[model samples]
Target: MKNKNVFNYLKQLHADNAEYKEQMAELKKLPHEYQVVYKEIQNFLWEFTSGDGMDMLQPMYGLLDFFKEGAGNQVPVLDLVGEDVGEFAETMLHEIQAKTRINELKRKMNERVKKEINQNK
Candidate 1:
């Protein structure tokens, strides 16, 4: 039963991956302006994954949403791309928030420790 479940999961995963690749190929077939945006996104991803910076997130997400809305429901490829960009931006925002909270906690802890040390002296 366990093996059957694992096989089913793997099959679904493979199917989903194939669908994603097909969608991307279709996106590549878009007209010049759309293709330009797609290429820019590709370049952005390469830079992003290569550790360029988080500053590009906002602008990229904006551009993605703009294109997606412009294409509307007629273009599933654009919608998917926009959704992906939004997800990425959300993830980055969460990470930044988490780091900020951690820093605040650390600062409070350090302040408390310093006060305790000063009192001892």
Candidate 2:
């Protein structure tokens, strides 16, 4: 019974990891404009989940608003260009990977805790 639970948990973790990896790969292939927004979303989500010192949803939505404005021609192209854009892109990608690892660690820790609980029971 314990083996079954362990196996199921591992399987779910693997699936979740794979799905996130695929999503990241797809995001990487997007054009520069869309990619920036996608990366920001990933960053915000990761930071939010990992107890970062920021209002995740608000900043994320704000970024979305910026993207939307750009798309609608309300924001100029210069707004999303330059060295800052490159830096942001790099930082966002790094955060995504970091967050993925953190989530995996958390999942493993939870599994360990569950195993202990089950054994105690």
Candidate 3:
């Protein structure tokens, strides 16, 4: 059973790698500005990566597609990302909900407050 689980994991990992390569190839076809912005956003978000970070890939894939369509219509990268980049990245992190450190801290703080209130009651 343990071996089977390992095999399954390896299979999924290989498939994911292949998909990532394909995504990268597609990304390369985009304009330089788009590529630079994409890499910047990717690096920023990676710092906040939670767990294995597999949850983050789906959003990135979507972001790439959105960028592609916008680029196709001649939309500037800055326009797609807005004037504020960091805020945009934070917003994306919130939407991902991958049990980040900030989220964990918030959860802990709430629990502590709840416990305190109950004890006082």
Candidate 4:
């Protein structure tokens, strides 16, 4: 479906009961690492359903936050690939820093332009 992100893909799957079941069956054939994530999500859903509906979302949200922060790949890649991965991570950090600086500069420039326009008006 035309380059949808993971959330949209998941929404589509959830919308179709038959397709969702079919995908669940297919998930068993995935690699162990991938299967583990699926299992964890299923466990979360089970808990989310069985519990009082409050606090059950924390673990699921925590898992999403872990990935959002790139913590999942950081240590494992370093452990598996050693020093080279460290250099790659360092490069990534520098790139992120550069992007942040560039964005800040753009924001400041835009604000100055807006202020000047307002003063002229």
* Model 4 lDDT on a 0 to 1 scale: 0.47
lDDT of 2 at 58: 35
Please report the candidate that would top TM-score against the real structure. Answer: 3
Expressed as tens digits, the lDDT of each residue in 1-121 for candidate 2 is 9999999989976876685566556545445666665565555455435444222333444445556556566555346544466566555545444444456578899999999999999
User: At residue 50, what lDDT does model 4 achieve?
Assistant: 33
lDDT of 1 by residue, 1-121 (tens): 9999999989976876685566556655555566665555646443434223334434444545555565554565445455575464455444434333345567789999999999999
- Candidate 4 deviates by what RMSD? 13.6
Using all chains and alpha carbons, the TM-scores for the candidates as numbered come to 0.35, 0.40, 0.82, 0.26
What TM-score does prediction 4 earn? 0.26
Q: Report the Cα lDDT for candidate 3.
A: 0.87
| Model 4 misplaced regions, further than 4 Å | 1-15, 50-121
lDDT for 100 in candidate 4 is 39
- Report the lDDT tens digits of candidate 3 across residue range 1-121: 9999999999999999899899989999999999998888888777777667676788889889999999999999889889888888888888877766666678889999999999999
TM-score ranking, high to low: 3, 2, 1, 4
> Among all windows of ten consecutive residues in candidate 2, which has the lowest summed lDDT?
52-61
Clashing pairs in 4: none
Reference-based lDDT, each prediction: 0.56, 0.57, 0.87, 0.47
Off by over 4 Å in 3: 104-121
Question: What are the runs in model 2 whose C-alpha is more than 4 Å off?
Answer: 50-121
